[model samples]
Target: MTPKLELRGVAKAFGEKGSPTRVTAVRDLSFTVAAGELVAVVGPSGCGKSTILNMVSGLYGPSEGAVLIDGAEVKGPRSEVGFMLQKDLLLPWRTVIENVEFGLETRKLPKAERRRIARAELRRIRLEEFADSYPYQLSGGMRQRVALARTLAISPELVLLDEPFSALDAQTKLVLQKSFSRTLSESGLSCLLITHDLQEAVIMSDRVVVLSGRPGTVVDTFAVDLPHRDDPLARSTLPATQAYVKRLFDTLHIAEGAA
Candidate 1:
């Protein structure tokens, strides 16, 4: 089967045409996200992690190579991809269910069908009680879970998550991390997570891909082979998790003393 997402020697540069001050964010970046696999890409600051997401989402075009979804070149945003960013961006006026229905609305789905899907997703996240509540009424972690439910409501072939849980408190972050990881695994959806947190990458991803600094390129990729991949807490204590986190830090050139 064709990979759900593929980037072959992809490079992205941002600048005005014919401008001398061009900035190359990514170079020779090639990787594939297989069906039902969650791949996490980790790198240091200014390493163009988010730029890779933009190219894959079709919000930005590659300067040198191709960004393909199921062997088809990405010309523009397609319905098969979902993007969940740091901000929940939930409409304050809209209720939790209403916010999730926004995409289904654009798809011209009937009101009943949209509400059914929206509530179903909310229930999956154990937020059914808040279906009638507005975004402002929810807690930060709750809002993020709502956002995840919204992203999954459409059932996209792949979801690109850009630090989706970075803003939460430590306790909330861990709770949501476990919940989201379990949900993604059970949903059987492909995902690409761009994050700066090494432990977060290992806990949430099936394979972790490390990138070099500045003009980011693939430096290393590791298949997380923990016995219990779905349980973040259970997996973290194992020696394999420690090894992967150490390797990731080493690859990012982070000194052991500083880390």
Candidate 2:
């Protein structure tokens, strides 16, 4: 089967060609996310982790090579891709359900149908009780849950997550990680997550891709063989999980502070 997503010899550069100020964010970066798999990317700051997601999401085009979804090139954003960031980014004026319904609204879905879909997503995340609450009324974790619900409401086949739980406290981050892992598994959605936390990568992903610093390129890839992938919290505590984390730390040279 074709991979859910593929980046072939992808490179992205900013500024005009041959210009002194030109910078390359990533180079010769290649990877794949298999269907129903979750892949996490970790690297030093400015390694273009988010740049890869933007290319996949079609927010920006790679200067060299190509991005393909299920064998076809991605020229621009498509309905089948969903993106979530570290911030909840919920509209303060909209209630929880209404916020979830925002994407559906943009698609011009019927109001009743939109409500039905949003409500179901809210229920899936176990936030149905807060459907009528505003963003300010919910805790940080709850708001992120709402953000997740909104991302899923459109039923995208693949979700690109950029540190979606980094803002939460340790306990809350674990809870949200478990929730997201379970949801992705049950829904059979493919995901590409960019995070700085190696532990988070090991606990949440089936495979972890490490990138080099600046002009990011694939340095190494590790397969996470922990049991119960859907329960990231449990996975995090396992000795095997720490082993993977340590391996990642080693690959990234976290202790050496290599630039």
Candidate 3:
């Protein structure tokens, strides 16, 4: 079967089309995510991780190589793909359900149909009771859950999450991570999570890919072979969990004391 997502000999550069100042952000990078798999990419600051996401999302085309989803080239943003950012990016004027339905508004979907899907998504996230509440009224974690619901409302075949839980408090972050893991598994969704947290990557991903320093390239890859992969708190206490964490830190040359 074709992979859910694939990048072939992918290289990206920035600056003018023919300027000496142009800098290459990524070079000879390639990877693939199978259907229903969650892959995490972890790298240092300014590693061009977001660059890869933008290229895959069709927001920006790579200078060389290709990004293909479901065996088709990603020429532009398509409904089959969903992107969730660090911020909720919910409109305060719009209620929770309204925010969830916002993406479908441009699809020419019927009003009743959009509402039905949005309501179902809210129910899935256990936020049906707050469907009428505005963004400001919900806690940070709740807002993020609504954001996740919004992403799912469109029924994306693949989801790209860029630091989705980085903004929340430690406790809230862990809880939401577990919830997200369970939801994604139950939904059989394919996801690519971009996070800086080594522990989060180990706990949430089926595989973790570490990138080299700036102008990033795939430096190392590790498979997370732990039971109950969705439980963030429980996974943290496991010996294998620390083992993966240690390996990642070692690859990045980050002192264990600093991590």
Cα lDDT tens digits, model 2, 94-122, are 99999999888778677899999999999
Task: Give per-model TM-scores.
Answer: 0.96, 0.97, 0.95
What does candidate 1 score on TM?
A: 0.96
- Strongest candidate by lDDT: 2
Question: What are the RMSD figures for all models against the true structure?
Answer: 2.3, 1.5, 2.5
lDDT, candidate 1, at 132: 91
Ten-residue segment with the worst summed lDDT in candidate 3?
A: 250-259
* Candidate 3 stretches greater than 4 Å from native: 254-259
Counting clashing residue pairs in each candidate, in order, gives 0, 0, 0
> Which tens-of-lDDT digit does each residue in 1-259 have in candidate 1?
9999999999888997678998989899999999999999998878899999888899879999999999999999888899899999898999999998877777878889999999999999999999999999999999999999888888898999999989999999999888988898888899999999999999788899988887888888989877666778878888879888988988888422222
Off by over 4 Å in 2: 254-259
Full-model lDDT for every candidate: 0.89, 0.92, 0.90
Better of 2 and 3 by lDDT: 2
Candidate 3 RMSD to the correct structure = 2.5
Ranked candidates (lDDT, high to low) = 2, 3, 1
